[model samples]
Target: MTIDTALPVAAVMAAVPVRDAAVAKRFYERLLGATPDDSPMPGLRQWNLGDGVLQVMVDPERAGGGLATLMLDDLAAAAEGVRVRGVSLDIAQGEVVTAVARVVDPDGNAITLVQA
Candidate 1:
């Protein structure tokens, strides 16, 4: 079969709702190695993590239990940066680009940062 299509999307945004905006902001800042650009919304923040944006919004009734795995070029560096920021590193699994490390945000959201 043959089909015609345009190129894929240029960017993506991962929106995550947190119970506390302040805590969420701090957690993401540490994970991304930088602060997120504050959104005009009263309780929303965003961080540009290269290929995609990490969005955090405040909602007292929010719940956490989602995972966002990032494909990083420099897994060691990224993991080190997170550690330097006081984030605990999990046990490493797999090998090469398949290695994975699961870390939790201040709000208790689980995120897997991998090299692939």
Candidate 2:
């Protein structure tokens, strides 16, 4: 399969903004079930997810405004795992998918887990 685009695309990464790196790190650590894989630069934490990466960046101006929906094979198990790790997310039925769990990070950035 090929995608048509005006500009060529190589790799993709996502950035989630937060007010404080320390606070954000803690929340993501639990939510993701591990510490960041890399901190390539100051004020930025990166996690390699499959072929992509997710970055938690310190940007107060954009904090609480970023959103991302992650694909999950088992939303129920994943939600329970995170909950046991001390992170809480609300699970609900979705119109386009089987189910979805929504969570707001320490800085309020929205993270949704979708089961398809």
Candidate 3:
């Protein structure tokens, strides 16, 4: 007769729209350092981003680019890791332990990696 209020929160996926699924897939693969889960639908790709999946969907009419944010263990390290792969990154001035680095995908969507 007890409730499980102690259950931790989890993130499954963050669906993002792209102009071209292939391009998006390549972008994410390079950024995340792994291939994504292919879909039979032919217009979507899902990359496994740790506890969650990042879905790159094809939708030409999709708006609101550069609108996704992600929190990571070490933002600076994560950004540096990806930077070596030739990814253009932007970091905001703040505490090193609590900094944010924004990275843009080929589709122009921005995802922020924060240190916390």
The reply for model 1, stretches above 4 Å from the true place, is 1-8
Position 3, candidate 1: lDDT: 75
**After superposition on all CA atoms, what RMSD does each candidate show versus the true structure?**
2.8, 2.8, 3.1
Tens digits of per-residue lDDT, candidate 3, 1-52, equal: 9878986767767877888767777787778777876674778777666787
Residue 14 alpha-carbon offset, candidate 1, angstroms: 0.6
Q: What's the true lDDT of residue 107 in model 2?
A: 81
- Model 2: per-residue Cα lDDT over 5-112, one tens digit each: 777767678899999999999899999998999999999999987667889999999999999778889999999999999988788999999999889898888998
Which clashing pairs does model 3 show?
Answer: 66-110
lDDT of 1 at 53: 77
**Candidate 1 TM-score, C-alpha based:** 0.81
Q: State the weakest 10-residue window (summed lDDT) of model 2.
A: 3-12
For each candidate, what TM-score against the reference?
0.81, 0.89, 0.77
Sorting all predicted structures by TM-score, with the top scorer first, yields 2, 1, 3
- Write model 1 residue lDDT over 3-61, tens digit each, in one string: 76987789988877788888887788887778776686888888777788777888656
Best by lDDT: 2
Residue-level error in angstroms, candidate 3, position 105? 2.3
